[model samples]
Target: MLRLKSLGIVSLICLVAACENSGANYQPVIDGPVGPNYDIDLAQCQSLAARQGAFDSTTGASAGTGALAAGGTTAVLNNKGTNVRDAAIVGAVAGIAAGAVQQQQNKAAIVRNCMRSRGYNVVG
Candidate 1:
């Protein structure tokens, strides 16, 4: 049982990390004009995207917290055979999904805002 609990915790951490690190790739467009300065603007947008991704890493905090709560619950109900495994699997999946969704949302918003700030009308 102890080994199983350890495995479940490791699994949960991996899932949450994967979800938080996920992001969208978007190319910025120039709506107005930048002919000569296009390269500079593009580089700036790329930097902004990287910063945004770093800033958005916190999106998975909720997922991690949820996983911790689930772990606690599993520890409590771990007396029966297979119950801990089943609960941990379900909890990890749900938390990962939630975190992934939030991460994607943050990535898109960042791209859109960054492009817009650069005088580009970004389209999905």
Candidate 2:
């Protein structure tokens, strides 16, 4: 339905905007010519990102649980825009959106920290 789609679009935009704000002003140092040192440093930063992201397992699980719980609650509400199919779609969207935001935030933090530590001014 148009209403459902619009709700989803709004929710998605709000969610993405919120996440984008987490690193909105950040400008990473990816300038200069590519070379071996850049590649090695980038790889190290990626490794650090992986480690930093690992801390999000619990957060991810909690987000999943919350989305599912909210979805179920919406269905039980049985009010407008709370039908079963719509509830499921909302739940899936919420879970995926939240997970994606968390990952992006983590990666941004990792890269910012890494670059900053390497004497690059990462402003956020």
Candidate 3:
């Protein structure tokens, strides 16, 4: 009951964060003149980045860890912590949200690195 509510709140937060990140347009900063293949290279790199999905096995593991930690902490703090399940749900949601943000960052890095490997002076 309470756990479900907490999970709902956490889910909402993660949803909002994901939406914000997705709406952002990422552009690599070039240090010099653009080559003729610049567009092609960029398109390829972006395609690669797009293929990088947000959730992975690590994300699932993190959620489990969060659940365990939250449940344990809640139990310890309140003895009969009726809210243990709720806390666990919230922790798992937080972990999932963190994972999502991390993946977004990873995608950006991939694009930058791909450009750099192609001999573009990506300053950003």
Candidate 4:
């Protein structure tokens, strides 16, 4: 009975080894543009940034004009005019910079969608 049990154990080990050595045939689906999709997303983000910048500039110009009209020369030389305009310009520049950074992130999402549509596995 001991000999029989030993033989059974050896057989089980052999079977497991064989299963481990079995080959699997797998084909991955290739999808989407082979390159980074940053260009398209960057363009979109730039457009958005430009729009925001224009809006900020217009608002700043209007505020500066109002300040000038209100306080005359003092407002023109002091915080009322230049300060508000500078703040608006800075805000516009900061917004554009943020938009550009966001574009990179958005590009990854766009690339993922494109790849999914073509049936490729997106590495998380």
- Clashing residue pairs in candidate 3 (N, C-alpha, C atoms within 3 angstroms): none
The CA lDDT at 83 in model 2 is 67
Q: Please tell me which predicted candidate would have the highest TM-score against the true structure.
A: 3
Report lDDT (Cα) of residue 119, candidate 1. Answer: 69
lDDT of 4 at 39: 47
TM-score of 1: 0.51
Give all candidate RMSDs, comma-separated. 5.3, 7.3, 3.1, 28.3
After superposition, which runs of candidate 1 have C-alpha atoms over 4 Å from their true positions? Answer: 1-24, 29-34, 53-61, 64-81
Please tell me which predicted candidate would have the highest lDDT against the true structure.
3
> Which digits, one per residue and each the tens of the lDDT, describe model 1 over residues 37-97?
6566656655555554322455456556665677669878675536755565556556655
- Better model by TM-score: candidate 1 vs candidate 4: 1
Name the lDDT value of residue 24 in candidate 3. Answer: 24
lDDT of 4 by residue, 1-124 (tens): 4454456446544543443212111122334444465445444433433332212234344544444454454435675755554444444444443343344444445545454554455553
Residue 120's lDDT within candidate 2 is 55
Residue range 1-124, candidate 3, lDDT tens digits: 8657766877756674554435123569999999899888988888888777765458888888888998889988976666887788878877777667766777788888999999999999
In the range 8-53, model 2's lDDT, one tens digit per residue, is 9688777765655344233466545545576566567766665543
Where model 2 places Cα greater than 4 Å from the true spot, the runs are: 1-27, 30-39, 51-55, 59-69, 79-89
Ranking, lDDT, top scorer first: 3, 2, 1, 4
Q: Give each model a TM-score.
A: 0.51, 0.48, 0.80, 0.35
Clashing pairs in 2: none
